[model samples]
Target chain A: MPLNITLTDYGVGNLYSIRRSLENCGAEVTVVRDMKEVLDAECVVFPGVGAFDKTMEKLQPYREDIREKLLSGTPALGICIGMQIMYNSSAEGTTPGLGVFDGDVVPLVGKVIPHMGWNQVVSDDPLMDGVGDRNFYFAHSFRGNPSEDITIGTTEYEGTEIPTFFRKANTYGTQFHPEKSSTSGMAVLRNFISFAESVL
Target chain B: MLTKRIIPCLDVKDGKVVKGINFKGLRDVGYPPELAAAYEKQGADEITFLDITASLETRQTMLDIVSETAGKLFVPLTVGGGIRSVSDMRDALNAGADKVSVNSAAVKDPSIISECAESFGRQCVVVAIDGKRVDDHWEVFTHGGTKPTGIDAVEWAKKAEDLGAGEILLTSMDADGVKTGYDIPLTAAVADEVSIPVIASGGCGSKEHIYDVFAQTNASAALAASIFHYNECTVGEVKEYLRDRGIVVR
Candidate 1:
């Protein structure tokens, strides 16, 4: 059965291509721009771009709805900023996150603000099935410093290790965009969908 | 032990690969997917897709191509050109791109760099700057190098890093297609000013040039179009030569 994947669209996101990529992987993807569209979903994905503070403001009204969906045990994936919002607080903003993980979104210290290009990915999860230790593409200034148990994978920038992929319970998050990450990136997405299906 | 990177930049229009000389004399290269696959086979460390069309209609076509190529190629791919919003960056990334490169958009609204980096993470965002020599000073250009933005290259590079840009694809309009070599001096300047990885573009005529960019300049990677596309040399041969010169490569 095709897993029903709902990508939340809160006026700012990269959901359409994410939807297409999920569909390409044979998952039934629905781009849910409205809060209620998230009701019936096997997997829910939050795709975001821009500031943490701004995203929080846009999603505040739907906090209750998001919390309900998450508590229901539906698989959820957060990309980039969406992933950061799963934490407690971020250096980029004063707004609190979803509190799914006990951590904070901190900036990449020592190095420049935005850590760009193909940095390495140290895979340690079933979701990272075919990815190797080679450099995976990256672009972020801030990163989530989750607890050791939730840190699934990591990448280094200027000698400091940062979490590149995070997972906890049915909730998963990728600091890197699986959609734009090439073949290994696609493998991650496929694995996530597979996981979502098996658990469902 | 950082592996040296070799990136092949593809200029696209109407969803087809196109090649040009110094931003002129353009000719269709091939299909975007086919060319990406070839570059992947050639052992390109990464591939970049630049949308040459400056129209909304053409941008949609580029998205379709990105979806097609991302479905097939597994290597790291960077997509740029006409990307204005965070949503646009998300579109490229969701289409299976590893990074979204912004040129004019970032210059017009510098905050987009941080906005994108904050949302997508810095690793997935690249800022491409088209540069040209003016009165012995490097100046940033826009509109496919048709207009000058009057922004100093060195200053802008630092500002971009501050704005949360992960990497800077520095292309020299004057040196592009000329095959003289990468602008080592300019690359060195930018590399010295910023700590992030710098991908030097616009020149690269021979294997020695690759070595020169890394040795003479602090550039983390070197990118070229005509040299790799026209079969002047392969990435392996260049890496082998660079390795012999004591440069690390994967």
Candidate 2:
């Protein structure tokens, strides 16, 4: 059966584009704003934008439900701000995070803020194919410093080796929005969906 | 090592691709996504779409085109032409544009560059300086090279970098459609002033011009419109030519 992917539409994300892209790749997608709709899906995507504190506040009501879903081996993929919230603490917000990963979101210092545009990803996984040593689209200021075991790929800027993608069993996250990453980004979504389905 | 980039800049009108010479005789270039895919297949380093016709009616359509092309190209994409506010930048970035270039908008408010860089990161922000020789000094142009800003081109390029711009896309309005060659002096001037990468746009007619630009100027990359559009020079051919000239390109 095709994976039932729920892209949480918490009034923060540009979910339409992400949903449409996943649907095009033959995945069953549902745009959800409520916890009831979320539980019906096997794979959950926490795609968000804006301040980390604000995002965490908005997700507060559903945090317990999300935690429950994740601990049950339901795959959860976070994008951008969503990924930052997975870490223990984020400099962007005074409030704490979900503490799913042992890391913190820190600001890009000295160099320009909001490390936008495209940069090269140092990857050794199927999620990043055909990208080679080229550039992938990025738009963020704070980045996750994942523990060694969770980091899957990285992108460097000014000397900072930021973990671009992180994976720990059923929980996966990308500081860069793969949905917005052009073609190579699509391949990542495909990989995540496949990874979720094979979870036994 | 950094690879040479082949970029195709589309002049967009009401969300459709349009092209012309010397910013005149506007002609249709078909769908933006189709043109982007063609360029990507030809091994383009990136694609830039500029909404030439800056109008309220065209804004939504341009966003749609940006979203659509971003999906098909699968490489770095930059959108420009009518960006004004952070909201505009957000709209374009959300639509899948990897980077958004601001020309006229940045001139009106110099801090917009830093503001955008702060929100989206410096790498996502590009300051496109349209330069033209005015009385022996290169001056920045606004409104698609229709009006000239009093600021000196070289000075402005450095200021843009200082303001947190990740890269500079310098276009010589005088050489834009001339197809003679790049303004090596102006390119070198800006490239010399800034530590960041400079993309040399305008006045590229042949592979030799690319070699000359790289060999003569410190430009990180060379960008041409008509030459690449008309198949006058392919990126591989240009790179191979540059390589023979002892310029490092990957």
Candidate 3:
């Protein structure tokens, strides 16, 4: 049986692309906005693309519910700003994040405003299986500075080493868009699905 | 150190890949989704699909094509041609396009740029300027390079950036199909004028031309069509050539 993945749709981010990518991975994907649907899913994907404050506002009501699910070891993945929001806070806005992870999402020190395009990722985690040293697509101005213990993958831009992927127990997050990272990106998603399957 | 990008543009007309010489003489090539997937496999940084048909019915067809193609490929997909409003941009984004490039419509009402940018983040709005050399300066052209707007290309680029356009797609009509090279001076002027990323389009015959533009101008990315479509060189080959020439590419 396929994994029952519930992707949170708060009327932000590229829902179509993420939904399509998950479906392509053979998971039974359902986009949900209700709190109950989010808590009941076998796997939860919180994908985001927009201002931090607005996203936090949209997700405010579901915060405790999502936190409870994640604390119980539900497989959860956050992509891009979704990953950023998993942290305690972000410099992008004054709003506090879900605070599942003990860190901050801050602006990248790179010269470019939006580090948009593909870059190499170096990792040893099972999530990086078959990913190797291949480049994955990234398009964000902020970088997650999660504690080193949770960091599973890292990418260098300019002189700063930003955390690209992180995994702590069953909670996982990536700063890059695996859905937009081409073949290797698909591999990362597949690994996440496998993780979800293992829990099943 | 961000790497420069090499983008392959696939023009679709009535759901089939089409190539036009100097923005005219349209001819079918193949299925767009298959062509796009091949480019993705060949290591293209990004793929752009321009629906040349630009009609109501054709727009729906393009949306279906985008949904199918975007599902298969993981790279960024930018769709252009006949995107007139924020709702149109929303439709494209909902269909799975990462960015929406506005050309003729933006020229007519510059506010559309800010509106789209405000609706969707500026990162999703790309202002495509089709330019033709007029006297000493390049003038912006509309209606797929058929109508001269008399707007200075460089000035328009700056304005577009000010109006919240995250990127500019500058295509030189004069040297479009000639393929001698990119319009270096034009690209340089616009790139210098705007702080946002500028993608130099048209007249990319060889890898050296791509090198010339990147070396001589501040353009962040270079776009090509015929060369890739006709199998002159693969995207990997171009990136390899660029890397060998002391340019950084992913």
Candidate 4:
């Protein structure tokens, strides 16, 4: 049977691309704006773009439901700002995140603000299986500063090293957009789908 | 360090890839999605699709093609041509476009830039300026380089950045199709004036030309068409050439 995935649509960011990427991974995908549907999914993918404050506002109503599902050990994956929002809070705004993980999202201290383009990421996590030392597409101004224990990958930009991938329990997060990152990115998604399948 | 990007631009007319000299005399190349996939395999950092048709009927076709291409390609995809309003930008983004480049409409009303940037983050809005050298200064051209907007390219680029545009797609009309090289002076002027990323477009004939633009100007990326479409040089070849020359590329 095809893996069932529910993508949270906060009415912000690039939802269509995430949907397409998940569907390309041979998983049955559904975009849910309702909290009930989001909580009922076999697996959850929270993909986001735009400002952190705005995304938090849009996700406020479903915050409790999403946290409940994640805390209960439901398989979850967050992409880009989606991953940033999984932390306790963000420097992008005063708005609090879902607090699923123990960390704070902060702005990247580099010459370029939006570390846009493809960059090499190094990780030994299962989600990064087969995606060894490959470049992934990234377009964001903020970087997540998660606790050391959850950090799974890092990308060196200029002189600074930023966390690019992380996982805690059943929750997974990527600072780059795996949907837009090409072959290595697809491998990440496929791995996530496999993880979801095993849990199901 | 941030790597230099090599982007392949596909000019789509009625769902087919087309190329022209200085924005005229169009010729069919191939399917947009297929060409995009090939470029991605060739190691393209990004792909740009410009809907040259710019009509209501053709817009639907362009959306379908964007959706199809976004599904298969993994690099950043930027769509330009005939995008006028926030709703239109939303449609393109919803169809899976990573960035929307505004040209003629933005020249008519500059507010559209802030509107798009405000609604979809500054990163999503790319203001494409088709410029031509007239007398001593470069002037911004619109309507696919057919009409001159009488706006100074440098000043306009600064204004766009101040108004929240994340990047500027600077295309030199005079250098286009000639294939000598990019308009280094023009690209440098805009790149120096604006803090945002500048994509140098038009007049890329050889790998050396791309290198010269990156070496001479502060452009974050370089965009090409004819060379790639006609199989003169693959994206990987250009990248290898750049990498050999000490330029960082993914």
The better candidate by lDDT, 1 or 3, is 3
> What is the docking quality class of candidate 1?
incorrect
Q: Candidate 3, DockQ to 2 decimals?
A: 0.51
Tell me the TM-score of candidate 3's A chain: 0.94
With candidate 2 superimposed using the best TM-score fit, by how many Å does residue A162's alpha carbon deviate from the native?
5.1
The candidate 1 chain B region of ten consecutive residues with least summed lDDT is B20-29
The CAPRI-style docking tier of model 2 reads: incorrect
Model 2 residue A79 CA deviation in Å: 3.8
A1-200: candidate 3 lDDT, tens digit per residue:
89989998767546777887888888999888764687688899988566677678877777887777786899999988888888889998898888888899987765445677778877788888887556888877778887647888888887767778888769899888888877787888888999889986
> Across residues A1-200, which tens digit of lDDT does each residue of candidate 1 receive?
68888887766534444666678778887776665666666789887565688667756676666766775677999988889898878998998777777889987776444554456778668887776544555557788987647887887767777777888778888887666555566677888888988888
lDDT of 2 by residue, A75-120 (tens): 8888888888888888877888877778788876534444544567
Q: Using DockQ as the measure, which candidate wins?
A: 4
Residue-level lDDT of model 4, residues B202-239, one tens digit each, is: 99999999999999998999999988877788889999
Ordering by lDDT: 4, 3, 1, 2
**Candidate 1 lDDT score at position B218:** 73
**Candidates sorted on DockQ, descending:** 4, 3, 1, 2
lDDT by candidate, in order shown: 0.78, 0.75, 0.85, 0.86
Better of 3 and 4 by lDDT: 4
Backbone clashes for every candidate come to 16, 8, 0, 2
Q: What is the DockQ for all candidates, taken in turn?
A: 0.21, 0.19, 0.51, 0.58
Show pairs that collide, candidate 3: none
lDDT of 1 at B185: 80
In model 2, residue pairs whose N, Cα or C atoms come closer than 3 Å (at least 3 residues apart or on different chains), thus clashing, are: A113-B121, A114-B120, A114-B121, A115-B121, A116-B123, A116-B124, A117-B124, A183-B74
Best by TM-score: 4
